[model samples]
Target chain A: MSVVLSIQGLTKAYKPGVPVLKGIDLDFDERGLTAIIGSSGTGKSTLVRIINRLVDPGDGTIVFKGEDLSRIHGRQLRELRRRIGMVFQEYNLVERLSVMENLLCGRLGYLSPLKAWLRRFPQEDIEHAYQLLDVIGLSNFANQRADSLSGGQRQRVGIARALMQRPELLLADEPTSSLDPKTSVEIMELLKSQGEDNKIPVLVNMHDVELAKRFADRIVGMTGGRVVFDGLPSRLTDDHLKLIYGGEGWLQ
Target chain B: MSSASIPAARPFESSLGAKLLALFILAYACYALGQLDFSWPRFVKGIDNGARFLDRMFPPSFKNWDQLLTGFIESMQIAVLATFFGVLISLPIAILGARNLMPSWATWPARLIVTLCRAFNPVIVAIIFIKAVGFGALAGVLALVMGSIGFVGKLFMEAIEEISMKQIEAIRATGAPFASVVAFGVLPQVMGRLVGFCTYQLDANLRNSTMVGIVGAGGIGGTLFAAFQRFEYDFVLAILITIIAVVLLGELLANYVKRIFNGES
Candidate 1:
């Protein structure tokens, strides 16, 4: 019901004169799935990354949990990050580590470096990891190396690893882009259900318009870094799609 | 028409300068050989002496078994100790040297230290350390530690450089501390490769330990050198056999270490 993450006039430009995110403004609620849908090079991924501060915004105010994330640095920034979780397009699980170990890595911010290095995780954290693995349907594969899993299974581990943080907010950058259609739907469903179950906002950047419509409670469409559409999925019409993607031939 | 059929060809002949350079190198090699008096007679005489020496090396005698045993054990100790400390020290130094991980200023100092350590051959390093530490396993250990930093440190830095930056970015996004970032992101990607480097360095240190002793650094090689000076060829043969056996045993142990760390293995 309340704003969990508030972004106001967020801007990013890799080159001084060439701005990638011209000026963006959006607010994320504390529950349900919010899909960021846009065509390629529209700065959807950039917007998500800026939210997590993986890519620094040129100028913006990102106020999350009453703290301005853009202004924070050092230990304060790291502490802020512990409350937020992020997933990647490529899954990005440490390939050499076991699923159990990779899941525990979500708690890396909470553990001492010496303890993490020694794999001396707290019993509660280990129990929570196992519970998360079970939730993600990867209980039997906990001891298996991440690289040994299939695309969908690896993404499951990726999700479980993020959930291990017990984060207040979740950001997934194209979580199902590499998967097959059936697997993509399954991953989307998992993400949607988990977001609802945890009562946390999950902001996902996706190119699959149909998949986004199917799962998103609210759809935010962008073009050239500006919000073009912000409403329920049912309200996203052909006119909105034309504006979000540009040109009518692709839709046909 | 296919793209392959396009004619963009040229003559594949060497330029005049290249031909003359080749000719000059051949001439210089011939002149150098001539100055060195590398004739068939000299080669034949050398072969005859080699044959006589080979004849003397046969039928190895373990006349002083107790002394040989003590020397062999010391060689093993020197190898194990040097390898353990060398790999231990190289881990953090290698991380600091990685160009991708650290700034150029930091990498330069780390790289320079590794280069200087590797610049001297272990035998030369052993000679210097023997002078400093007064002739024992301590000198042998120090020399091999330099060797380990030279080899494992550089190799470990290379391994760190080759890792996927995308993985690191994902971890950093979590807002993990610097140390946590290394433990979760950097170490996982490089751990298997680091294990491989350490075991190979250990095997190399095992072989070099024998040679360091010849500089009076306390190992089986010192005993073998003394036997050669005294014309105790049979005792020397015994020491050589012991060295070969030790090197092979170290190789097997290194393989086991690799297996334990390699996920698939």
Candidate 2:
């Protein structure tokens, strides 16, 4: 498959001399899930955040379809951001807004500010939001306030909101961390299926190792802000786990 | 259990410093009372004068009904108009001052404007406006608008600052422009609080408008001032009672507005 994204020598440190993702090189081309698993504070979130431009990379070059994502500003950055959809750990739905309105937020980039302010979203977007609502199994909840939803329901809506962008690439930052096990699996399934169906690469940073192995087509294991393992789930040995996470007293 | 392992049985203690501070406050209060013209005889004479004044004000005569009616209507108009204009102006300033959404360059100026508006009392603001715009209802409206912006703008900025950044990020990631991000993400979170601010400004404006008239800016205070100056104590009492009634009515109306905007059927 042709490369959709390529990251070269990505290095970042919140404080200088203590790098988070140090000289990391990765590429995404295939249309499926690639899970990046690491213990907390390994800069998995920071890696994805820089890709979304939510966090600026200290030193690196991110090329998405031959465009340097790290250097673009203002209008160019917004145009680039449209092709990349991100889902947060907290679901991030506008709490006081209606479910339908929250979903329409996916199209906020497409509509003018005046149109959004007036809530005059185009007809196709409204229909698409309704369809996405059904896909996420919240058909009757379009009018319900987002705050009334459970954690799982909100995450489901969050996934749908991301999908509404029709993004070329989807980045999820520990999407299932706040969810129960069942909900986590369900969310993973939704992300995987949507990734395949839309033919968009899904890059996820997760804390749960087994969950990543089960759902990911390819797994990248990281430790201390560096990638330690990159291969299939079968190749992810206990030795590799120990190397990635360091010291396995809890593994017993 | 060992001493370190076992938690303390008593988790609370009143410090000696606190007790000392309380005693100092009490002593200062006693000293201040002694320094004032607060003798028992002075208090008794004051009470006697108040009773005599109340007796004269018993039959509150609305002898000049037309003049009273005009002043009352003018005050109501001033209050309503000021509230409308003030809330509209404050809305943008509030967004500007929110640290989360805006940078320091924008927030500092907006904050300074809000502070300037709030620094002066409404009567002081009214006198300033009277000097600028000439003695009329226009001065009252301008003064109250400044007061409303100062009071409501700070609260609005605080509400905006408290909103979830995740909400803004989600919309922004969708490729939405800055305006759309604010419209969909920022405004929804703050709309309820904004409605509350508007209603409060209205309530405050209603009271301030009448007072502004005393400074020759406009309203019922002019009539009240004239009555007091003419030794028409009964008419002054009538005006005072009418003011209290209107303020109470305004409170009820404000509550109703708040409820309607809160989306309670």
Candidate 3:
């Protein structure tokens, strides 16, 4: 399989002395699901954010396709980001916008200001949005405001929005963290199927070990801002869990 | 638990400086009243003069109804036109003034423009505009536009600033252009409040537009001032009544506009 994304020596620090991501490296391939499992505050979300450049890195190199992400800025950065879809833990839908509008938000980068202000999206884009609505099983909620949707339904719209980008790589920053166990599994399944159907690599940050094991072909365990384990889920043992979670008591 | 286990209270004391300041203000008021010659005899005579003024203001004369209608209508036009122009201009100013969107250098200048517009009273601005434009309703409209920009623009900027950046980040991450980010991320959150502010500014301009005419900036106020100068107190009273009626109508119109855009309604 072709390498979809490559990261080398990625480091970020809000303050000079305390670093969040301290010299990290990663490589993602163009198929299946890869889950990043780690304890709370292990910089998992920051890693995904840096991949999308939502939060800029202090020092690093992210080569997605052939372009170096860290060196891009302005319109180039925007274009790169559009091709890489992202899903947030909180859904992050524009609450005031209608469900249909929220789904089409992914196309904003492709439309002109005049077209966006007038809400005159291309006909094909609108059709795809409607189709995605059915795909996500929320066809009846096209006109309803996003704030009126349940957490699960909103997250579904969130997924549809990311899919609207027709992304090469999908980055989900703890997408199931706000959901219940059943809902979390359902979302993971939805993500897994979407990745397979689209033939795109899905990188998910997760806390649930069993869910990750069930869905991920390979699991990357992170601890203290560095990758501690990178292998098939079958190889992630109790010893590896201890190293990733930083405690023996919680492993039980 | 024993009943006598309570702690003793501390004594409360007032500051001597506060008491002395109060006494000084009281003495100053008395001295100022004396200087103004506000005696019992003068007050009684002033009431007699007020009675004469009220008597002349009775049965408000509508003999100059044509002039009253024209002046009042002009004032209404000035107010509506000024408010429309002001709100149109303020949209961009508000965007520029948002701290999250613009750098400090840009926001500072945008804020300074709003502050300068707000610093002067509409009447004072009318006087200056009247001098610049050589009188008439044009000057009144211009003055009120400045007033509208200052008040409405500042309010719109603050509303924009208060929007959730999380929504903006989500939109930006989708690879939206800066303009698209504003339309999708920024505008939806602030749209309802912007409409409310625009309507409010319109109502305020309607009120100020009447007074701007007194400075020869053109409105019913010019005619009202002439009536006062000529001792036609009844005619002045008619203009005042008309202004009150127009202002009430404007308030009703503003509320209707707000309702139309509320979406919930």
Candidate 4:
């Protein structure tokens, strides 16, 4: 498989001298769901955010699609961001807007402010949004306000919004953490299927180990801002989990 | 529980300072009443004088209907124009003043402008505009516009500041430009409140439009002031009745516009 993104010596600190990500190095495949698992405050969310430049990195060299993502800014940075899609833990859809309008927000990078304000989206974009709605199983909820939807339905809309970008790389920051167990599995299935269908690599941060192991083609376990395990899901043994999570009591 | 061991129950502790302040206020009120020559006989005499004034205003006259109609129309025009222009100008200024949306430099200047606009009452603003623009509906419109800005701009800025930043971050993540981010994320959140502010401002401008004319800024207040000066109490009552009717109509119109814009039945 081709490498879609390569990270080398990536490090960041919200405060001086106290780094959150400590010289992390990893690679993402072109077209498989890679789940990163770790305990709380393990820098998983920070790692995901840094890939899209949502949270700035202190020292790093991130090469994605042949360009250095660490240095660019202004128009070039925005252009790069348009090619990368991100989903949030809270399903951060515009609550007051219609579901259809929220989906069209993914295309804002291409349209001018006046066009967006007037809601003059191109015909093709509208059709694509409708198709995505159908895929997400909310085709009839096009006119409904986003805030009126349930948690699972909102997450579906969030996934669809990310897909609307047609991004080469999809990054989900704890996409299913807020969901129940059953809904969590469903969301993971959807993410995995969508990634395979679009041939886009998905990098997901997750807390649930079993869900990650079941859905992820490859799993990377992290602790203390460092990856201690990187291999196929089948290779992640109980001892490895203990080392990554740093407790044997929870293993039982 | 032993009474001696338990601490004294002090659920409601009243402040000595508060009691003293209340006593001071009562003493000052009594002193001021005496100084102003307030007495039972004076109040009785004042009531008699008010009754005689009311007797003169019993029969309202609308003989000069043409002049009243012209002044009323002018007032309406001033109100509509002021509301439209004021809301238009306030939108951008409010956006700039929103601390969350803009830098401190931008917010400081925009907030300062709104403060200056709110510094004077609408009547005082009308007098200033009347001096600058000369006596006409234009002065009235300008004065009401300042009042509208002061009302809507500050409130709208606060509404913008209170929006969920998560929605904005999501839009920004899509690589949208700054303006597009605002158009999609920020405006949608605040549009409902903005409609309410605008309708309320329109209603206020309508009422102020009439009052500004009394200060020679234009509208029906000019005619009403003239009748008052000439001791035409009957004509004054007619003008007052007309003003009340127009203001009621304005309130109804404001509600209707608010309902339409807010999508509420």
Q: Which predicted model would earn the best DockQ? A: 3
lDDT of each prediction vs. the true structure? 0.88, 0.91, 0.92, 0.91
lDDT score of residue A220 within candidate 2: 91
DockQ values, each candidate: 0.63, 0.69, 0.85, 0.79
The TM-score leader among the candidates is 3
In terms of docking quality, how is candidate 3 classified? high
Looking at model 1 chain B, which ten-residue stretch has the lowest summed lDDT? B256-265
DockQ of candidate model 1? 0.63
Predicted candidate 3 versus true structure: per-residue lDDT over B147-259, tens digit per residue: 99999999999999999888888999999998888889998999899889988987898899889988899989899898999999999989889888888988899889988
Candidate 1 vs 2: which has more lDDT = 2
Which tens-of-lDDT digit does each residue in A1-252 have in candidate 1? 888899998889988998889888888888989999998898999898887777788897999978889877788877888788998999998887899988888888788878877879999999999999889888899899888999999999888888989989999999999999999999998898999899899999999999999999999999987899999999999999999999889888
Which consecutive 10 residues in model 3 chain B have the weakest lDDT in total? Answer: B1-10
Which candidate order results from sorting by DockQ in descending order? 3, 4, 2, 1
Clashing pairs in 3: none
Using DockQ as the measure, name the better of candidate 2 and candidate 4: 4
Of candidate 4 chain A, the 10-residue stretch with the lowest lDDT total is A51-60
> Residue by residue across B1-265, what tens digits does model 2's lDDT show?
4878877756677889999999999999999999996889999999999999899988999888788889999999999899898888988999999899899999999999999999999999999989998998999999999998999989998999999998898888888998899888998888888888888888888899889999898899888898888989999988998999999998999899988987741
Candidate scoring better on TM-score of 1 and 4: 4
- Winner on TM-score (1 vs 3): 3
